[model samples]
Target: MSDEPAGLVRPDRRRPEPLWHQAEMALRDLIDQGEWAPGLQIPNEDRLCEMLGISRITLRHALRNLEEAGMLRREHGRGTFVRSATMVAGVRGLTSFTDEMQTLAVSPGTRLLLAQVISATREIAEALEIAEGDSVVQLRRLRLGNGQPIGIQTTHLPSARVPGLFEAASDVTSLYRWLKDNAGIVPVKAKEVYRVGAVAAGDASDLELPVGTPAFEVERITFDQRSPFEFAVSTMRADRYEIRSTLYV
Candidate 1:
């Protein structure tokens, strides 16, 4: 196949959809059809504009949409290139990072950033269904997929419930697995909420993204049986991860 993108056809001006939207969809089709492989720099803006018969502004609008959707990556002083598609996380189950990565046939790794016993603050206590100032095991980790950092998660578990959890595992690849094996506690259900926000400085460094880049802040309270036991906050790279849900009518 040729490296150059196939010729583009000008969109209909009378269509209800905006010209930029049409252009965006057309470009998206090209990417989905594998005309532009991942990591390959696409043609320059001038070329793309000419090919699509659109102005630079319209082409940029399309490119920006794709970039935010994780289908493209634009680097300063370099060029715009195809980005690897984001990994999809189903909202149907309470699955661990390891399980999710395994299902995707990617290697899952974790680097422990912080692990200690600390007093839970009011927010943490409320999330874990414990009293303020109660002891909790705080665990912070960098989640990796295929050796690439994808997210940073911080978890707080009631210390009274899981005594010696930190001491039991020095190198924890999967907290859920360790909890099951050691404490016989398996999270059966969880209530999770997602919001979009700017990346924090520390998290941006760990996730290797620019500070203030868009991120998905996921807050989850996991339960064993009917009692909440673990509360976690995860900052995931929006460009590399997406949350998917299946709705039944």
Candidate 2:
């Protein structure tokens, strides 16, 4: 097929890198560069071995590495195919959904689900550090990556802190960007808690996932230079999203 890797250079034994590692890197580049797009079945093992001038052992090793890294999936009878890119969010950096997608070279989009002025519930009030029954602008949105639904986020902001937010909600693609530009709420930090759970019925429909599918439930409280600025809860597709962290010994 046209999407198959072409003009592949055989690994040089003179180089320090191992043969399998070199083959692995070459295939990774094809997937990352979108030359071999998601869902495209790759060339057969025998053909790839011939093309790369490698043995079945070396080719299989390279393929195994890619499969473990979530770049390819193998079918029992069918050949291996490239998997769609998974969106990775770090527990370390505080970045907006739009920024994250852009950094990964994916187009980001938002579909507003619900927007209204509401009285803050006790939980919402505490998260925003405001009084109970205070006015709050509530916005529910479906977050998209590459035009596909990836997450559903419900956000609450104090009305006093974000005047006219309800009216402008539909046009707000990124909550962080909107807060900084219009409400002067520059989020400097955030605390996020994650839980693994099954998707709710309504949310599953919005996220285009089967009911009771695995998902990531995240609750976050964002802070500005002054104080708490926004509170958000998100349901993200487990298959399409990942949370990453770094550790020190």
Candidate 3:
């Protein structure tokens, strides 16, 4: 809860790396050491600039990069605050929700909302690459972290591919874990798309957000070996979630 800016070393003029990158690294070190805990307001921009012995523009560049990396949050006229470290997913790994939460030291829980066998609609069929009207097992769940609602997840699987899923739905906590243990299916890769969306009434209720609130809509298709086996859509509270991606040339 210290309001003062942590002491920062001035960027080395002789270093080949950019000054902004150096400043960013210095701030990152402070955060990693817990000098600036989550939700703690940082010093004003002028103070930070003076403390780092850098210009305002250079300080802004470093702050912007940290914000994009989910290490800080800036509010209009309210200054900046340290953000809680969040779970990060990259393109190289297919991780389950439980695993992600566990890695972040957050307890994960799931509440089964709906579990039934339904005829695949046009949308579900297209996503799963199945014929319309074919039987599909639909599972709706409320995802929780540390006993707080985080998101709503709905999954569709071809009924023939996962027979008896409905019968074991009540005992399931992690869909990926169940798939591996019961069906011997392991997700090796996935393709996901994300967009900002207005929360629907049902999803809003599950996420404990007001209807029409902004949320993150994530649609994913998971593959076991080379075959697509699961299609899932998750609506997460934008305030509590951050999406991350790594790019390569």
* Candidate of highest lDDT: 2
lDDT head-to-head 1 vs 2, winner = 2
- For model 3, the local distance difference test gives 0.83
Alpha carbon RMSD to native, model 3: 6.2
As for candidate 1, its clashing pairs are none
Model 1 lDDT, residue 9, Cα: 49
Looking at model 3, residue 248 earns an lDDT score of: 82
Residue-wise C-alpha lDDT for candidate 1, range 1-249, written one tens digit per residue: 344466444677888999899999888778777877788888899988777788999999999878765677789999999878566565446888899877654578899888999999999988988899999999999988768888999999988888669896466778888888877889999898999988998888889999999999999999998589899999998877886556999
The residue-by-residue lDDT of candidate 2 on 98-152, one tens digit each, is: 9888865568999999999999999999999999999999999999987889999
Candidate 2 segments whose C-alpha is farther than 4 A from its true place: 1-81
Q: Tell me the tens digit of each residue's lDDT in model 3 across 146-188.
A: 6878789999999888877889999998888888888888998
- The model with the greatest TM-score is 2
What is residue 67's positional error in candidate 1, in angstroms?
Answer: 16
Ranking by TM-score: 2, 3, 1
Model 1 ranges off by over 4 Å: 1-85
Cα displacement (angstroms), candidate 1, residue 79, comes to: 19
Clashes of each: 0, 0, 0
